[model samples]
Target chain A: MGILGVILAVTNLVVVVCMHISFRQYGKYKEHMILGVTLSEEQVKDDEIQCLLEKYRKSFRKYIIIGYITGILVIIPFEWYVSIALILYLVWMFGYIFLIQHIYVKYHKKLYAIKKQKGYTYGKIVNEITIDTKLSYAKDKMPVSPGWFLPSMLVFLIPLSNKGVREFILSNLQMSCVFIGVIVLVKASYLLIYYMFAKQRSQVYSGNSDINIACNRVTKRGYSIVFVVASFFDSISFFMLLWDEIAMGSMTMVGVLLFVVMQCIIVMGMVVGLIQIKKKRESILAEDSQERVVDEDEFWATGFYRNPMDNRLLVPDRQSDMNMTLNMAKPSAWIWTAGIGIGTAVLLLWTSVVMLRLDFVPVTYQVADKFEIIAPSYSKTIEFDEIQWVTLLDEFPDIKASKQNGAATDEYALGRFHIRNEGTCYLYIYHGYSPVLELQLNDMKIYCNSREDGVIQECYQQLQEKLSE
Target chain B: MIFHLNMSSETPIYVQLRNQIVLGIGRGDLLPGEALPTVRQLAEDIGVNNMTVNKAYQILKSEGYIEIDRRHGAKVAKHQKDDKEFEVYLKDKMELAAAEAKAHGIELTQFMDYCREAFGVNEEA
Candidate 1:
């Protein structure tokens, strides 16, 4: 629990720091835009505007200090209850996100107000979009072919080649499906993002077709390469699931943590790629001496691109992801927004509830017609006919085993485990408790005990009586 | 040359596109025989309806500023021919603009200078 708490603390700190830095970046000019408002090159140098930008930076930094302090105070102390600590940590993350977004919008509006006062975009063709006709005529080549996805898909399927993985998956089809389904969905969404980026209006930087082509080519290629590289990261988790079933140990948790680390690595790679591409585009922009810069600030007055003129369903967000935002003018955009909103809510709720259950629900047993042992999400029932023997041991079996699935913590292990001498068994045991009841079934063994010592003894006695009759 | 378009502008989108192209040509930014993007491509890039671009191309073609070929798409014409209909329309449009300029307290000399500047002429010239 302490180790997990420390890891969670580190993750929280990283997220908070990243959020602090990334949100601050929006205040600077990029692609001729600053704080979601477009500005003239001359206006960008204005003293009063610079002061406001300084305030924008300082304001977020001040808020971040408080957020960081609060996160440390809330997440670090409650390390004993890992579930509670995790929930608090998530809440802190959500709170920090809300805080940053709120601060960003507040400053975005302020910058826009200053822009209005300066008449930067006023009495002007602020909705100007520079398109290099020649470049447009020779349509941009982006979006990695669907064929590129086959290698990652093959890696995902590689686990099926192993006999243990196949049997494990076959026996627990639903659980495995849900797990695999999540990974597949993530990959599918990324592919969708890639397609949207391809379909998106290419960034037309200058009248010079060559400059425009160079800028857009690097941007698109950078995005394509980043997604392609990250596409293979998920395949590692597949082998992680089956590593323990063959070589017996707590490899599942290690695998999950490794997967997380890989995810972080991919995100860092994307950031690096973005930085390099931006530098390249900025360098090439110097060549095209006379280029029209767009200032569609009115459309993005709310800090989101809401252009009715832009026919594309998705647009590259000025923030983190390339295709994270919707073109609000499209009616279908509302459906997409609602879907995202609902999906996020469902995932958050499901995770919180699952975590809470793992910490609170005690191991339980009922022996009526069938011997049912249940704990949180991991539960199993053994039929009376299948049970060949039942024994109530005074001492807990100190057997070497590994968890196949379920919650494992310092307190208990409640799930499927493969015992070294006993083969596969459904275990519902608490470390603090003892004298567990063991049942021998046709193909598998069951070891479970209740929190109440008397209740466990009663269950064992009743099972024995029922079996004799 | 980059075409600056504003959806909320008083001028129609197609007219904005047409004016930019004409300016590019007069400024020599768009050279004679230089190819233009096809209607579909331009429309897609600018995120406008295809008809808007088609209208601009048709106007440019009718005024003898460009030639549209099935294979080569639209290309800037080597020579801009004088058309009676265009002269008449230009006269009417210029008269209205001059009237608007007068209302805005612009002198005839200033208006002439602005017009000359529009034609890419220096004050000394």
Candidate 2:
């Protein structure tokens, strides 16, 4: 296999390894870490929780072993399709994880019910731990400042100031700045809002209040650091795209590699941070004597959280304090759920449509007082009066361009592209199909060709006849 | 003022919001001409639909409990002297309450006492 295939295989292997690690860590945390209860108290009520954890762990371990073994076995013979194998593995892993989580949740709910019935109290020694308001609401302890992301806008200026860069942005970097800007804005908003509202102490537990606050502060700082690091990586990526050498040829393979590495580092960083925070919190809890464990029975189910009793829509996820989960009872939650469901369905449908169009759709051109070009994703009609000039070219123009819409492959170019010299042009030319007809319209250009050379000639003759008339 | 909405209640959210605002006004918790949270802000905070909050605001506006401006969103309306129309409306509502109380076997005096307590008015001579 080629270098690309080898790289892909290695990446796939790394991803599988990461997934295994993450799942194992999550399972470990779920099994051992009782959120409110002390270790001694947890042991007292551990019958069902222990049974559930054992069952889940056994199944989880079995699945991972089978999955990895199968993946390795498949990769041995069909290494070229390593990426596909990795995807299948991922699907299997996620499906199993979901099933296990569901089972765990079911068992947990039953256990919680039993505990409630038996009058099992968690950390009932109420000790009022007075927390300094400054510690609770410290600005420095907040997550990444939104201001750190504003520098990303400098990418726009890089293109605007230089002529070569302007052409690159208009053609190569078309709307990428807009996309990146939107992402930065969204991340900034989410971080800012989450820090401002969601990070507030919901229920201050006894003895561990200081520890809880400290944990939150540390986690927030970690998230901020992660965000800053991610933003820095994004800036690097944006700059990488500006390199003309990288923009051309198989350098995109290198870019993909860099992206994969960045993702791995980020994921590892987050996991380590989470594990560290959890360890610290557990240590603090172990040392503390006075603990107040509220009955969190109605609040969480399995891993999923939904409290009909709680009025708030966005609640902190039980598994991860950093993330938010919908309170399913809320009207807004239902709306958001429906919206996401519909959005996913629509995306799947659109993707299917695009695939079908790409495979089956043919380019068609006609002249009836006006010149019109039609393809699956690219379609345009040019007024006869607006036609500036028409020329037949034997070779494809070596124009630097970026696709605005439609497909541009080695075999054919069927898209709206912002060409360096030609401006915005609709291309419907097969690379092998010689003698392409070029139309220079009032404000834009059109390149047209057909699979059959005779058809192109016929279209050219017809266009000439119409122009003469 | 913090509004507590019972999601499980048979009463609609808009009606609950309207009732709460009216109760707040009656309890002197919400002063006349006091600015209320904008419909969007209230809806987001409560995690309800914007239209639900808007509907509540509309009800308040029609009842002269709040006035809505394009720039300022919604605010409590300035207190006006009790008019004959308001007295008629109040009488109509009180009659309905009296009928309900009678159906429930509540005496007229007890119902009046309950109303007086709710209104925070002095016991009659």
Candidate 3:
């Protein structure tokens, strides 16, 4: 098998292992404690929570085992389609996660019912915990400073370092960096806003806000560290692309591997942070005797937060400290959900369109009143009146340029580019095709080539005739 | 000051924003010449369309509740308590309130008392 195939297999295996660990952790922490009352216990024999946990654990194990086996079997037989198989495995993994979450939510509702029937306490009963609105809404009190996001700007320096680096970045790496940076910034901003505006829940036992503050701090730092690490990784990848020793394909494999590794690290960090927070919360609860229990009737139906009275769209999940759940009762929540769903669909469609264009779309040129060049992802028309001169060259021009809107490959360069001398130009050139046609327009330049030299000569002769007319 | 906009309310968002700003001014929560968040910032904070916020700002500016400038995007305008236009508008609103109260069989004293309470008038004084 090739190195790429091996790398894909290894990454898949790593992902599977990570998934297994995560599922096991979820099973272990299935029982949640609120207000010093552990309503459900997994160790208790024949209890509802334990029974439900066992069922989910068994189902999860069965699916994961089957998925792993199938993945290995497919990869072994159809090694050529390893990439496709890997994607399928990822989809299966996501499906498994969703199935487990559904099961958890279902059983959690049952647990809630049991707690309610047993007259268990949940939130604070006393109204003594007065919120200091000023302190709570203080944006300056955010655990991490905004300056931390500044490091992301360092990515711009990659292009300015050298000419080859600049070319590589503008052609290949700039778009990727922008996409990654935007995602990081969005995530960081959302976290900051959530931390700032989310209603601070009082500790059931005591009015001490220290634990709440500490928990928020931990979560903020944990999330920020992940985003910062991601930005750093993107910068590193850009630098790696500059190295002439590494092939682009191998570099892509390396990037994928790095991404998987980064994900694993983030997961581990979050799990550790959550565990520490849970421990601190428990310790705080043990020290206090006074308990306040509020009716959890709003969350009884689905074990999911659904309160028409609440206006917030994103709320901290009751099931996990590290995750956010949408408040299904609000219209804004629905709007956000729909927006995200549509955005994801659009992204998938755009990716498919790019792929289809690269594989199926042909590069076509026409010569009538104007010279028209059409290529995948980019198309241009050069008017006869704007043409200053038209010449056919036997070799490619030595121009320092940056790609703006089209594809660039070793075999062909078909795109809109910002050439050194010619401000913005359209290029449709095939390396093997001889007699490249260069048109110097009044404002910009146009360079084109074809599979046959005769086609270029005919186009040139046609352009001359049109110009004369 | 934090702007709390009710998305589920029958009132439009721009109207709600305007009413809230007016209420804030009445409550002395927003001071004259105090800068409000830019339209873009407030829109993002409330997760609403920017045009909704812009409309609110526009109404506020036209009514002399706030002023918009090129340098400082938007700010609460200086209080003009004796403006002729405002007096006419208040008289029209009060007439409507009086007619509604009369239709509901509310006495003038009770209606005035309610108005006094809403306006934060000190009865003892």
Candidate 4:
């Protein structure tokens, strides 16, 4: 391939890789943000809340590692042939955003609707000691959906994929960053928008009845901005790439660098948003926790806590996901996030190095060269047509394929694989460049290369062994 | 002691907390002049809003069930010669429960029997 082609190819690979990383990061960010919104301070105190946090954290950690590893394994050789995998991954990315994420969000809304239909939720009982009647606001009703900002942010992933104009820029470190920097100009605009809405909606959500409406509007507006900005970034980045020579000029480079700096600022803005939400959640919960202090006349007069709408706004009396924890007083959460973040960064850096090595090294020099392997027959187009799973089933019930990172060495390609069987079970194996598969029939270890001869020979050998066993 | 709060119950959490404390006092679970839990502690105990326990304590203080001093914490109040309200309160509680039980189609004997079973009473009359 020509130098420009190589650069374009590599840039695309890098951008997609970065986008994937960012996508995962955004997922975690959204997860935490949603949790931030949904979880009250009282809920935080609850063991269930802690469990869910840990659960999300664990899932986030697992997916990050899996994705990174998969990217390394899948992209190294595929970087040469990235156009195909890139297209596939983009399709999958869009599918996940529109299909999976959308469905989950819809389910959440449905559940919330059901709960709202029910007059009151019977919250859990908390503590074995110090039972108090007047202080208990457990029966106070709250809506299942906290508001709109969360859901909007969540579904932005779909539109983001649809607007792929910035894909090139987002992938190209030099140009993509310039696109992000240009968005800094819009921050003032975003703030202005936020200010306008905040002013207009200041008194809108004074009570429980306003929660759904207020939260909905806020989230929708917030999400709309996010999508709009993403679209801008996409197109602007593409345009910058179009005018590369001029864009790469000294003056343009300076602009590009500034844009990069602005992108960093945007990242910082996300961090600020995260912190503000957390602070708001904590303060609201703290205020709710002190609900028992209402005077006697106020208690019976308005029947505030007792009223269904009022109850939803009141603090829960049970051990919910939101509760104040003794541990919360300590700076442990920050320390934990920092520690894990550092560890994750280190892991990514290490994997990136490994992937770079894999990508740069010639295929002949790899461990494949070490094995005195005969070249596979280029013409032996064995399609594996014996009632194979992929073709026989209209939709394979449980066959799932995920990008495997580095689960196995270069000799045996490996990383992360996800398999889901929605219906009937059918066994199917992915045929890849250097296949390292442990078959189950008689438990045989089989290794094969993309070369037709090598694969067939290995298959025959495995079949012979299985027959003997 | 394990404190329970029923958020849905008509009884306010503070009243429940107070009632539990009084029961604890009568059962000799708490001694005279013993420090009861602080407002924060009581709030944490029942998992209800802290203000609920605080409200209960304020009422308890007025009724002389407990005394709150910053240095000493909430202590079981000293006994007084005039326990008139205590008897009236006890009678009122029994009457209300009995009336509710009767409304639920339970005879007085049946209600007493249910209470005995519930409390695992082995005391001879």
Candidate 5:
């Protein structure tokens, strides 16, 4: 498979596997919650509920297997539909999240119907808040102090550690500052989430206050430890980018590898933590034998926690333990959601614009008072006196270079690319076409080329005439 | 004592909170001089406005059911015999309840039995 095909296939596999595992988790009862719905002890043992779950299991398995195969088929159009593959995959991935939710919700509705038919809902929808007063004190300790996060901020020191990265950062201090600032912001955001979890209500899982306190301790520690440790893990991704600044073009993809790895590991760690807390809570309750849980079903009857009566800004997601969703009851939640949505749209729009331009826009040379090369997005002018020499390159060289900035596809390369030995080159070329015109300047090289016959030769003559004058 | 609050009750949040605490004290679930969660702590736990919890604590303090001081924060007050103020409050509540019971054709003995059931259930615990 080509790079696009490889990306599509791998992403498809990961999504399918993850969904398979998480989707199955909804089949079992966790804290008396199933498919975002809460149940009572007696309802859990009912024959109709068991039968409904069995029915859902069969259909869910069949749908998932079919979905995986359909996703795999996305690779078929890789070579022929190269330009659209990324956009296609992105659209598919977006829909995939929703489609899975749709399937889950379908079963949720059926279960709801059965619940109403059998009068299984034990109580009215109410904003019920449960708290162990002793465990809910403000002076309660965190798993680790804020000082633990100081180490995560050490991501700034990474570029200075490596010689090549140090030189790169020194050369462009502004870019380095931006990179460090982003890393700090991400770490700070994680810390904020940890703060929210720390301030969360202490659930009273049993009548014995000590047992309830222990359950809260384990749950808080599980989530808190993961967030703190995960923040430190991010430093590795920053180190990868620093290395990418120096590594050859072939190894440039190493930058993205650590970042993707960090994301996958942190997400998996959080899931593991969730499972650990759930199991431990169950075992502790078993020993205590005085199980108690509040019915906050009204707030969580839907996929979201939306209780205007409750003033919390964030709450645990009912459907998945992997996320802490904004409490829709708060105005700040709407603002945050809108902000994230707009930011994502703007980012996607910028990327799609660049990709489309790189693929479809042809580069053209205009011979005038000064030589100008124009691509759709930008144009560059070179004075006749600036060009020291112009030569027709019979074939493009096999020199390796790292892309500092700009966008690229298989057929074209544009913008600034850093060559290991040659310093820097401004590229405006159809790399596959020849003869290429290499315009040499005092301190840099500008490469220009086209697909049509004699275009480079004609441009070369015009540049020579201007230079001869 | 653990607080179980219902936001959907026709009663206001502060009233519900105040009632729960009073009941906890009556049932000996909240022992005399036991330290209660601070207003902010209770508010955070219930995801309610801080003032709502503060109002509940203030009412408890005024009624002599709890004491709020800087050092001890809000703690259950020492046990006290019912006073004239409490008796008047009780009479008003009982009059309304008794009128409703009379409307439902409940005898005085049956009403006394209901009161015993209400008071005895928690004492059994």
Candidate 6:
């Protein structure tokens, strides 16, 4: 099941990636930048920036395709080796994204300021091009590279470092096992510290003009410590691994698995984050170029585009941009929230299957069966307004009267009322039953279990993107 | 000697360079018609963007502190011959000196004594 699950995950990722590439290529071919942006067309006179961006984007697409193809190609012949290679490749790309971007972004503005002082006319052009390539690199953070160094390095050193001693220590079996445990704890803490710093940084950036970002300075000390501490733990693990009889354990195996999975998630989170930073920088540059001079608030206002001609505002109807920004701002928040939601649903689904296998719960409930059942759509809808809740309760009263799941009622002084009706129910209606042991006539496919769960996931993803912005 | 600039100072490099050039003229460190550094050379020497040095040179030219020729680099302007302009310059210098002494908490009598000493005039009699 785990193998199948991994296969399915890879397949889904491939499909999503292909879709993204096609969409971007189509966008490029069409020469279609995003709409509702208020940038003056003249600000992009040279299109050197756009051309540079497109070049990187094309390369990114090619690499992504090649990486996936290689993963599949290699895996068919050599499963374990290829799997490890693919994981390592992804890890390397992720680290490359972070480190390279930090360097580029840190130096970009200073370089531009120098250019401006030299009477170089196209400061905006250089800045925009810098931003776009960074974005492209970020999106392609997981493209496979040649496998010789990737897995070997990941096994020994963390993805970002290539120090010989560190590599030796990391790959040591006993040290690696201990390092695995340390990594899990460090990563979990990293997520928290990253969240706090990101939130604080965003607030500071979004606040006032006098508060310059100091151009890629280490704004968050705690997050830096977390990263450093993780590396330190890796060093300790390397030393520990030097000892025999320490590397082989059920706990060690679990820790290694957990570390790999968490790292993968972190890579995904960072990709999402970089995309967001790219988006923010793009919009900010566009806005900056359009305006002759900007005050503080103008710097912070990024969502809507202003018309250069009539000075009319064009706001996007969709909330996708907001979601994208939020996700970029605090990807771990989105990851954790979405993970919890999806995890719970998946767990419940599995538990249901398990109960049937163990004869703990009946395969099907009869109409008269008086077992407590949870109604779908209980969690998704906003419970803020009393009237909305009342209306929901009025629509379905049977589940409302039950004591389980705490169907709370709220009526505001303004005469609005909300009553939760789906949290508790005494009876469930089942139309048919299928025996598990017998061969099923048609495959039992899962549909949307509940709109609330589905919507929450979407909202979480959207919120993640929004916060990143 | 032509004035030189220190670029790495937190103060605007151009302002520092400009002040130094002005002081060079006032202190006779730069003689009349002395050749100054070319904008490019000055920029390189100070480790500043060329535009900053150019801006300072432009200001110096406008103030008649220096002049530039197509073939030659910037040069200090010849010493002023107009009596009215020289009188105004001397008054401005004296005012500036008085302000400096006041800033240093020196009394008017001490300031006069310092001025007399600078002029080699003894007040013993």
Put down candidate 3 lDDT per residue, B13-111, tens digits, no spaces: 889889888887887777898777677655644556789889999998888889899887787888745688888999999999999999999998899
Query: Chain B TM-score of all predictions, in order?
Result: 0.84, 0.88, 0.90, 0.64, 0.88, 0.68
TM-score of each model, paired residue for residue? 0.76, 0.62, 0.55, 0.28, 0.84, 0.26
- Would candidate 6 be rated incorrect, acceptable, medium or high by CAPRI criteria? incorrect
* Backbone Cα, N, C clashes tallied per candidate: 0, 2, 4, 47, 0, 35
True lDDT of residue A226, candidate 2: 58
- Model 3 chain A is weakest, by summed lDDT over 10 consecutive residues, at A126-135
Question: Which candidate has the top score in DockQ?
Answer: 5
* Candidate 4 regions with alpha-carbon error over 4 angstroms: A1-66, A69-469, B26-34, B44-51, B78-82, B89-121
lDDT of 3 at A99: 63
Error at A388, model 5, angstroms: 4.4
C-alpha RMSD of each candidate structure in angstroms: 5.6, 10.8, 12.0, 22.8, 4.2, 27.2
- Candidate 5 is graded, for docking, as medium
Per-prediction DockQ comes to 0.42, 0.03, 0.03, 0.09, 0.52, 0.01
Model 2: residues with Cα > 4 Å off, grouped in runs = A1-21, A29-54, A61-163, A166-190, A193-198, A202-209, A242-253, A260-264, A291-295, A388-399, A409-411, A430-435, A451-454, B1-125
**Fnat for each model:** 0.70, 0.02, 0.00, 0.21, 0.81, 0.00
Candidate 2 docks at the CAPRI level of incorrect
lDDT of 2 at A364: 81
TM-score of chain A of each: 0.85, 0.73, 0.63, 0.30, 0.88, 0.27
lDDT of 4 by residue, A267-288 (tens): 4444444344434444443444
Q: How would you encode candidate 5's per-residue C-alpha lDDT over A121-220 as one tens digit per residue?
A: 6533545776676777632563557677777777666556778767766654555576678877888798888887777766667778888778777777
Interface RMSD, all candidates in order, equals: 2.2, 10.7, 8.6, 13.8, 2.2, 20.5
Predicted candidate 2 versus true structure: per-residue lDDT over A1-469, tens digit per residue: 4334444455555555665665565545341334322224455446765775676568667766765665445444334333344344444444555654554555456555556666665433321212222233342435666566556545545655767555655454555566457657755664565454434332333344465556555666666665556665655554564453224622355665665565566556666766676666666556666544544545563455666755667776666665567888678998998999799668656765664565457788888867777777778888888987788888678775566665655456678776655567778878777788888888888888888658777888888888888
lDDT of 4 at A19: 39
Please name the candidate that would achieve the greatest TM-score relative to the true structure: 5
Least accurate 10 contiguous residues by lDDT in model 2 chain A: A125-134
Local distance difference test values of all predictions, in order: 0.75, 0.62, 0.60, 0.40, 0.75, 0.38
